[model samples]
Target: MASSLHIDLHKISKFVNLSIPALFVVFLSAGHFVSFYFHFFTVAFLFMVIANFFYMTVQKEHVILKNFGLMGQARYIIESIGPEMRQYLFASDTEERPFNREERSEVYRKAKNIDSASSFGSQQNFDPSEIKIRHTMFPTPKEALQPFKITYGEERGLEFAYTITRPIMISAMSYGALGTNAVRSLARGAKLANIPMNTGEGGYPEYHLMEDCDLIFQIGTAKFGVRTDDGLLDDTKLAEIASKPQIRMIEIKFSQGAKPGKGGLLPKEKITDEIAKLRGIKKGADVVSPPYHPECDTVEKTVAFIKRVQNVSGLPTGFKICLGKVSEFEVLVEEMKRQDVYPDFITVDGAEGGTGAAPKAFLDGVGLPLLVGLASIQDCLKRHGIRNKMKLNASGKLISPRAQLVAFALGADAIYSARGFMLSLGCIQALQCGNNTCPIGITTHDPELQKGLVIESRAPRIANYVHNIEHDLEELLRATGCKSFSELTEENLYIPSDTVLGNYRLNSPEVQAAAS
Candidate 1:
């Protein structure tokens, strides 16, 4: 009898799990005679006990509920908040994905105009497969590094041949994707920094033009701002939008890195009346853009559409793409050559570059990464003898000066950073971008949340971010013994021999010829 009464440690969980439901049942049985003051509490407790008892004994769907009863619910609650727990407490500085604590801290420091120097050596693993920049014995003086400038539409000679002095520009992020304050803040920052900002294909540039900054109006697959009733590009609307003095260039987005084949998605919960009106969409349904433009079903048609937009808008026009098939891109270049027509610029979006929400499969397994895609696109254009015809802009996870320099060495003429600018705007990386409940107000439309993002304070941060990047870029260029970005070449970069990228670089015709 004594042995039977002893508690077995191994069965403690099972005992507790059964005891909890039994206690609730007993408490509820005694609640019938409770006084009037305890009536409300008794009813609430009775409901909870009954529901849990039903789940434990009757519900066959969840085995945990059947075995552990109310205790099983705690497991679900903990699991639901697991991501937040890992992000804030469990994960180390470099263990997080998308952007780690160390990377985000660097951006925040630069944005705040504070010294971002690190005391210790890099926390990075310094794996043999990693890429490194080759510094020269003879470093160039800072004065020797000339100011960088890239002129769009220089080859075509458009009426507005936009020249950007700085290589870093704000990437496309639609007003609908962001709040009014966020957009205006970015515009003011762009004005302060004397840089261009892309109006992410959000139908209208109303908020983007608030501060009189240079604007690159993006025409997405849906043709939001310049679409006809039939969902095709409207020349009249396109001309009207292009007529705005702030509009300097036009980018036709073929695809972004987040979801290569999948189109843009805006949750219905985020669709406000203003957003619905601006996008010409209904309020109740999720907004899913067409995977491809209806008018651009083939490569030839795509080129023709580009020409049409350029002709109508009379602006420097280009296209943004997340490179998927090399063969398809080779065909596209061929078509451009055959037609004797080329875009003013080409924005190569890497698979790793997505500031918007997207499906897990598409985000994880889709287009080529920036380094590989940019190199391939540059190689293809060079092979076709049209490398000089269009400016090449690269966008991915390039938030720092070193990363930007690597892109230049690989063939990027300019750099666009969406997440970098986002961080500068005080994003906490809550990973709640898809939901409408962004605590920081950068991505949320909620007025209460937006109150946190004061435009006056945030705008300078953006300008500071750009200035700091420019300063560091010049410093890096001087260290590389390069007078200007034009002097950077693939030889200025070194990759470990065992990496796939290294093997490709070593065997490439260009490197082989140079080696010989």
Candidate 2:
């Protein structure tokens, strides 16, 4: 009996490591000293009662705690362990979700190049009567090709013609906010995997030039990082950056999922003299991005702006947006058709997207979730008969093969992942990224934390994850009899929840035109 208690106690310590007196008891109890053990047990009993009483009585975010209480500090410690506690105590195999332990374990094993295949039981268990199911019919036979390549965006025109080899592309994170090494590593990783990396709204960092990988230059409303004297598109800057062979695409950041309609903010401390000079903003002041672009107002102006950059840059030009109103999109499409201008691609980010910092209301409340936005965007484009005009990219929690496949099957030419890369660099999802105290250096500017992230070692792991997911997708493609990823059509996917099993096929609005 004592041996069993010791084993269980050790397991608790291994998982939680509470960093408190209660945990000290658990550690000593396993030491095989029975007489002194009663004293340790008494201490443990007292600690548990005091800790629970302190934790359960008050909500952490209460104003009282903020003004004059220690409650918030205690809550912070407890919240930090939320992941470990959920995993060890309450989460059964069936209950774990949102990139569950099972999926995370699989990623780790596959990264090590081990064969991590599911055995026997299903990865998911549905309530027999409550859930719905749907599937495709007349499935095509699988074909042969590259290991990690797959189709990512919409399949209609300039986009339908190309395929993304790896599902794991870098997310839209600004460079000024991240250290020089962070940007360099991301670029190097993308170069190694034949994938692309987005140079966030902060503009093209000089360090990003070193790796010479595929680049997606982002232009935001603030126009802080790159703009001319007229405070508009800088032709010289765009031409120089876009002329680089590594720069494959450009994305205008109209809005993002995290804080739709809200603008960018650079704290006084972060607004370094260098960034201020480059951005044309005064130093030592709070930098607030304009809510909308002063240079462009309507869809016509928006398209013209896109054309301005595309004409000088001579590369694929796209825009990233989190959808809001359907009518707004309809208007935009109508204007695009009328003006005879087309975007090379569009990225739809889900409302659940995360950023280093954003207003709470916008983070929780604004923009449509990605699945809904993708459906809306897809349906609108098809209805406008402009589906053939552009490719589609999806972002927001699309790190694994299944998630990426769902985005593609629904309607996305490619997908981007942010938190996933952070994960590769040893982020435990502690949510402390916005502060300059990140322990693993995935999201902070602190030199000490930055030391922990070995860009050299971690970049390859990032590449490994990209390759691993693509290989997994290849298995699915093989099951669908598709040799080339570009050949995958919506007819290959079905939601089991809908009860539409292998009975139907999807048709693009211009299916006839493509067929002809």
Candidate 3:
């Protein structure tokens, strides 16, 4: 009886499918005979339907299209817009990954210089797995908090040692990774905020130098702005870049948090004439940087390279890395000690860091998160008795003052925020940074899209966002009974017993010693 019913249903389905097109033809014929306007409308509608039907049936690419015909097209249309629908209509404020509505809204509020205080209780889940800040009975006065400042290369006695007054500075967002307008606005904003900006490895940093802001020239594996024809570091070009008054420091990037082992990928579609000229690459092809520097293949070579860059640039020089294997870092540190050639600073980019484009495996599965990496590195440096030799800068999803405070407690000397500043310039978290279709023009190079990001309007917002974060940082510092970030210790942070951080803390010798 079931088999017979299935057969009957199949026949009925076929009949309905055939009858719908026949009915459409009859309607079109009637419309043609009835009225000219009706005929035109029916003809246009039928043409679209017929074209879609034929295309879906003939298309062999999608299995669903071949099987379900026009229904598959409808499904695809709905699926294509699923992200937008979920983001705007269905997803809760705390549901989204990377950045949720609540987080983005906080940044937006701060960027607009509006009050970002919450009315109701916290939306955060206070589960046993959550980390919390431990408050003391006696809170420190706001006036007692010291001004935040970190001097790079001061110990090394470099001629152009740079002092950063703010703990939060804009992280590396390259020109080719971002649009021209976006870069200029960020530079202007950095100037207004009195914070330094890292000129990402996109070469030359023309736009970054246009504004009167302190800049850190980054040299990627590709050596974009300061590379020879064979893609090796060019000392002459490096010195020239360092000579710029705005160029306060130079960072040799080993790897970023987003793609620790993988190189940066700039799509061919986004590459323009200016980007090509600056990067010293061809304009018509995708630019894939090397995974590691050609000259610094071994631990010994890496140390020598740092010293070489520092000597040639005549400025504070550092290296950035996303911590992977602890033993590998131990070897590097050991080598640095042997050679007595330490970088001025070490930027530890966490796995949660943002990037324009990276493979899913690297982005999601690779490298250590900020707190873990920062704490591990701190422990290692302290154990090796080199903690005070160099500054430890942290980067990854550190947008809020609370987050920055946690980083401070974990041993981060300074913080770098890329997406935070991007949000200040009105990024909608569209997740189109990889493509040349950023709706807000922050990431895309498309002229039409770039127009949406106005430098004059957006620059001040960046300044506002920085100022607000600084203000909140002071407030949070006062609440913690700490005079400054320098005073924040791991004891101030309470990690859940069942969490990964808790496990690490339990295993940490430092934590164990403190408990003993």
For model 2, how does the per-residue alpha-carbon lDDT over 29-139 read when each residue is reduced to its tens digit? 754466665666657755654654455455464553433233344566898888779877777655654456666666665554567777887766544522122233433
Select the stronger candidate by lDDT from 1 and 2: 1
Model 3's lDDT to the true fold?
A: 0.88
| For model 3, the run of ten residues with the poorest summed lDDT | 4-13
- For model 1 the TM-score comes to 0.91
Model 3 residue 209 lDDT score: 84
Per-candidate local distance difference test? 0.88, 0.68, 0.88
Model 1 agreement with the true structure over 321-415: per-residue lDDT tens digits: 99998889999999999988899999999999976578899999998898888888999999999999999999999998888999999899999
Candidate 3 — which residues are off by over 4 angstroms? 1-16, 28-38, 41-49, 52-57, 265-271, 282-288, 509-516
Ranking of candidates on TM-score, top first: 3, 1, 2
Q: What TM-score, computed on C-alpha atoms, does each candidate reach?
A: 0.91, 0.74, 0.93
TM-score leader:
3
RMSD of candidate 2 to the truth, in angstroms, is: 9.3
User: Candidate 1, residue 249: CA error in Å?
Assistant: 0.2
